[model samples]
Target: MTLSYRVLIALLTPLIFIYLWVRGARAPEYRKRWSERLALQTVPVQARDGIVIHCVSVGETVAARGLIEDILRSYPQLPVTLTAMTPTAAELAQKLFADRVYHYYLPIDTRGAMARFIEKFAPRCVLILETELWPNLLAEAKRHGAQVMLVNARLSAKSLRSYQRFSWLLGPIWSALDLVICQHVDSERRFQQLGVARERTVVRGNLKFDCQVPAATTRAAKQWRTELARPILVAASTHQGEDAIILDAFARLIQAVPELLLIIVPRHPERFREVTSAAQQRFSTLTRSSGQTVSASDQVLIGDTMGELLFWYAAADIAFVGGSLIPRGGHNPLEPIATKTPIISGRHVFNFQPLFDRLTDVNGVRLVDDAEQLAEQCLQLLQQPVQGQTMAAVASEEFAAEHGATARVLADIQGLFPPPNGQARTLKMILTSNPNAATEIWFDDNLATAVSDDYFAPSFWRQKGQIIGSATGRASAWFIQHQPQNMLLRHYYRGGLVGKFNRDRFAREAIVKSRAMAEFSLLLQLRELGLPVPQPIAARYQRAPIWGYRADILVAVIADSQDVFKLLLQRSLTAAEWQSVGATIRQLHQAGVYHSDLNCHNIMLDQAGKVWLVDFDKCGFRTEGEWQQANLQRLLRSLLKEQGKAEQSQQLFHWQQTTDWPHLLQGYEQA
Candidate 1:
């Protein structure tokens, strides 16, 4: 080759490598940091069907430990593999299952990741500890001929509502499962409602009940018990924004029972420093049990260690489980119960309802409504040791009766992990015929058309802005089909593409059009229901600015009708319209749908002077008194926005007496 060409190649080689390095660094961080370690799973050959057990985290791993030992004892020749998602759980499994079972981190839920994982381990059966339902993981497992089952499954009511919203995504995943061994009847019923076949779902009481409480080290327990020389209250698994509430409660109990000792354990060990600082600031004398030394002067003791909750429970007079009192679902209360400690908890216990309900039914657990209540309950228990021990006895009895579910669950596992019968059915997925064709059709645009320019390019955004038009009014409309690489727009119609207007602002222009369409449609639907609402002619789902997911409703602008708040300010509406608005609010409240937002913007008026309501996103099943009070407060806010609070409050009180709530009561009764 020529000298110039040779020199050029030499210079560009290093540049190419640099360019590749930069590009690779810019790529999304796909591979997890610990994934490589997980990839070191040993493949078993000439082994019995692989026993794959999935435990979500530490608690689950601990619960499954007994079951794992049982499974191994039953079939020592069977190769066993354990998997966990969290790094903490993986480390815990490594320590517990070391040299016994193959341990690995679960792959990400992408089809490629799951495919690689299943291909490597070749597990005959997969047992998910709880409700770890990933769509791609389940689908690929079933596709690759692995039997799947959900063991120790528990579904809450709130979880039920969330799953209902995504039934489309969950339906196929549930179908892939061979069986679901739920924890309670309520959980089973919820799963059945979501289309999991009733026959496939079985109620196996919680494995936590079967967990053998770690025997307390006699020397250690004796030393701590002597050091305290008083009754101890153990607050286990406390979360952020909860320590203060628990501390306040503990302080109150301390006043009543002077010999009370408080031991607080936060959920995450990483927050040890922060919690220690807070404890020191709150209590005059605080002791951190990090080392072997145990001090007697310590007013509040902070549990900064790990895997010692059971030991602490064994050393306690009563247990107060955290992550409750606040809005968060409470942590597991089963440990305390199994330890035979009288349990006290806040209202939020959705996560451990079955155990909590059983404890409450037998008067073994105390329900504390707030911080004060929690402290009061703790004080009552400590002052009355006899009563506390009685409660603890009930807890022990309830837990003992619910044991032995692990064996029943193991019996069910054989059905899913069966021997190979014949060749497995194979089905190839056909994503597309044309390799370059756009896959996701959002409205009508092919996202590929926008590939030349980057997403944030000034020129691209300028063009996009122009296509959307000015935000003030309706400008233009376009169909956008988005792909991973780019976005595409289709300009022509199916029959005759006649309308051709602004070229620059198609994306910005769709929102006003969509909102107008939604508003109009809502009005039309309301009119059909014979409810008072503005008249509407047309409606459409706007498919531009927000990737076509949000459709705006539009209605004709009322000529003379004003919003009730605006009318009230001008004194424009007759007494009849005001009465109608109040009556309509009552009617809606009685109908079991409360306007959760309860804003005046939601209330509309027509030219004929009729009142209407909009926005169903925040609506929910609420009490009639709450809805009425909320709506009244909303009206007062709107009036205060226009006029002062004095004017709003004056009119509010006047209307309260002038307007007959009894007439509105009649409208609500009629509805």
Candidate 2:
């Protein structure tokens, strides 16, 4: 731990306690177990060797509930301890898993407290929800040989900047993690920027999206359908100032349609009474907690109950999710989406921007600004039932589309355990980095280079013989014939948006993050898994004075082989050949390989019809799920793109539909 951090924690520890005490004034649960929060009340003589999961607050508690339940259901043999930073989280966790999980208040991050907590749990693994960067807690757990994982992780730009300021202090804490399950590609990028290795980070999607509304919630929603007025609007999770604007909008909407009902759910329970008093001045209102049934005569409903936001959405014809109206980062839309209720969102939704983007792009969500715009938008959805239904269908479809991430994450959890047959490799390598810059080169211990670091450079390959040339529409590689082995040397070239600026430039990165170096390491792992792939001989890179670098990797080539793309144009692939292709890819998938750019050209066939996958650049292992279908779809698209130019090419590909496609899918299914 950094001395400055320790000193800061020491200075602020009293204020932290004060803050907890103040919170306890509103909700006494925070005061009930003060000792547990300090790690002073634990008296267990023996530690439980299972898993410990930490959730920071209510949002995190909700997100992790599914994952904890999954762990209990799937791996009931191992004990579990759940810890929360806030009393609300602790109470919710206990309620969710009262007998199933051991629930406790997480201790502060002092070294002694963290060490004591670690010792008490003696957890086999520590899985923390979201981006909680408790340095002492993580470091202590890791020191005790616990596998530390950051699950459903993400970082906003603001958070990233804040973390970068103290990166020197926190880099080691991040490096201590054995695995990091990121929410998306962007989160993976941010984590990588923060000194995380590509191998350890996996984009497993956000678990919040994986949540299912309780069957009780769905069943209760149905009963609410008959009570509310037509075109009823729910402004769920409304913050301080947002209620007035939504109420104003509802007032205007009421003018357009005389019988409209608006149910406003304030975000905090403490504000429920205050908001209800203010709202009653302009409309006929009733509080949800009053044990009074709402009717068409009631122009407004104050949702004062805790955690029935779903039922309110289900009761309404239209739902306007509130935190979006003001500066408060938006609440989740999944609750409304769960019931296929039409949604109206205010312009701001940075918290779940990607989710909102997917919704609004398809008109699944109607974005509005202040009172008038919200009134107009809500009126539009209310009047046009077809439009509402279409938006609702697409919104539900979009939500359904994000579902498979849970299974993929579970696969990653299973991957944490060692192989049944002890097939894991004890990989050791030689690594050297530039002192002047953040660049590194890695090579297998058995391999070494006599040439300079530029051995894999283009000039070196051009001076030697070349099998692949520029005319192939890819001037990226050259096949070299050597005494001991034939190797394919590929110069790293950028793809996508960044490539336009500099095709061969990469921001000088750490040892494990270098594209060429990471790929080389992965190929070694793939080869050991007995997959048909090239052997990596050497990899190296050169960093510039300031930033950006070029790199390359040399892998032993498969001789006397032709890519499936090339083979297809020459002749139709036999059914056996197609089956072999499916079986070959499945072998890698079973070993947890995620070929990011799986294409017909990547798969090769030799004289004996043996198949091998090559060009494993920008690829790594991922928890397998819908991605398998996506991979197949990408290969199919690649084949069509490659062959669509001519009927002769088409006939060769189309011929396989009857024989090749069927057997290929069958082989995959069998595997």
Candidate 3:
């Protein structure tokens, strides 16, 4: 079956290019990036041995944003390569992640292209968002020993029957999946009916429900609302046939409420001009890209801009989720739900029928049958603000209840990446021994070479002219300028008065119980939990006869970051940044991590303003208890103590107890 399918794709290769050329006539971006489409581009060194996520179009890309961010936070050490089929989705991925992730066009699903892609990236895992299943792509990844999983997977009965009709071709492809994280139980059953093993499928809720309105987006929406004080109706992701119906509905809605404004956003970028032209034929229209301020007399606005759909939804008093007025199914209604906006949709929502059904059950969305009903619903919602608010409240509650899918999906993805020392084919750790000195070294196998005790010696780096700098604490930590990456080497030392007598010595213990080994293992566990922490490079223990053993560990430096203590000394953190810090701490606590010392010094803010927790020397997992609160209090005391010292020295410290602490707490509780 696979052979026949490949033969068919090979035969249609020319037609595929012709199709692309045809699409390029309407949207020129389709003709761009042919090298990426053919898997002809060179993979960067940093992107190798990482994870590849496939989001077919803009909707899938938007839905997968939360999941991708969680993946990045959990495995800060691993690079992520994002691939999309459409130009809009490609552009959206770039705008969303910027330089944080590698973006590329997914290679056409051919044997040669798939092989080159898999070999170049050498990805350890491939995650397919939603339902983009290509036979050769899955087979090549599996052939190269990369785990493949389908996330936010949904298969309606219609799609299931369609796949079942060609079971011979798709059965093996379905079986190739390491796991299928479904959005509904019905989807799980459909996948099982096809070919997936029961053990390999689990039903996690929809990721769209986990979508968050960014703080910046909320602020922008607030400004927009203040600018346009009149009632606003946002028609989002409209399709070709649906725009006419929506325009007709707006025509009728204006008779009842002349001050109401309609903002229509087309689903595809190529249709933006067409939709804008159509809306202008009926009412005074303004396109968002025109940079023209909207007047009170303007009744129509075209949201032609990309990546501002959420902002429009937030600014709207009522949202009409488009594509349903015609037979094109519908876009995600959860976007408006996340923004606490009332929703109205047409009857045809089979693409997300289960979700729509659930929302309808709770009176969260009003379903319309035609233009007449759509206008009626819009007028009713506009006239009765309290009714609209009540509906929005119910939808928001349901949306909030569906949270945690991102966490669940992260857990499943983490399961695919086993411990470095485990028998996982993806990552491996090497243990080198020196029987002569009762010494041992544990290091990542991906390192250039197997490290020895000499690698731990400061003199080893100093002799090679690799020592870049040093930091003062109870013991000094030396920074090494290693090729392709930087490293920090720290020797374990006893703190306080005990450090004066025996700075680096410890009682004899088993190798696994030693400080270096324990910390190394804990770091690995933390990475698996998806917490942002320094990557452990190598750890060693050198025996000192009867006295005990001395330990040292080398970890990769987090690039472009400073400890919060250092950042606060220079400038005050924005309210959002403070909240992010609190949210990050909450994530650690939720993961059962008990940082022996949770202080401002241990918290880091990267150049991108991502919060990171470091220095887990004595930290370990603990059961849920009062220690979480105590841990937070410790961080607060550290902030206060630093502020006091700075005041005495007449130095600047930018922390406010009332405002910043409350914002932090808000972020913590929300997270």
**Most accurate candidate by lDDT:** 3
Question: What ranges in model 3 sit over 4 Å off?
Answer: 418-671
**Tens digits of per-residue lDDT for model 1, 1-671:** 12343345446545644553454442211123444332434443212235678887777887787778777666454567787765557656766667677777776455555666775655557889878776756776776566889989988888889988866444446778889999999999998988889889999887877866645433566578887687888888888888888878867776777667788887765556677788788774454555645455567788866566777887888898888877788987777777778888887997777678988898988888777988888878877888889998988887787889988888777555542222211010001111122111111111122222132133454565633321111222222222222221212111223224323222333222233322332333244335554333222232434433223221223334445555555554445655676778766665545565555555767777666775433244444455567666665565446455536466532234234444444444454
Residue 361, candidate 1: Cα error in Å is 3.5
- Top candidate on TM-score is 3
Candidate 3, poorest ten consecutive residues by summed lDDT: 419-428
Residue-level lDDT tens digits of model 2 in 257-278: 9888788888766577778988
RMSD of each: 27.5, 23.2, 19.8
Off by over 4 Å in 2: 24-32, 42-47, 94-99, 156-158, 227-231, 256-259, 290-292, 295-298, 417-671
Model 3 lDDT tens row, 516-559: 86787678657766788888788887898778998889888888
- CA error at residue 350 for candidate 3, angstroms: 2.1
Query: Order the candidates by TM-score, highest first — what do you get?
Result: 3, 2, 1
Instruction: Give lDDT per model, in order.
Output: 0.61, 0.76, 0.86
State residue 375's C-alpha deviation in candidate 2, in Å. 2.1
Q: Decide which is better by lDDT, 1 or 3.
A: 3
Query: For candidate 3, what's the RMSD?
Result: 19.8
lDDT leaderboard ranking: 3, 2, 1
* Candidate 2, residue 262: lDDT: 82
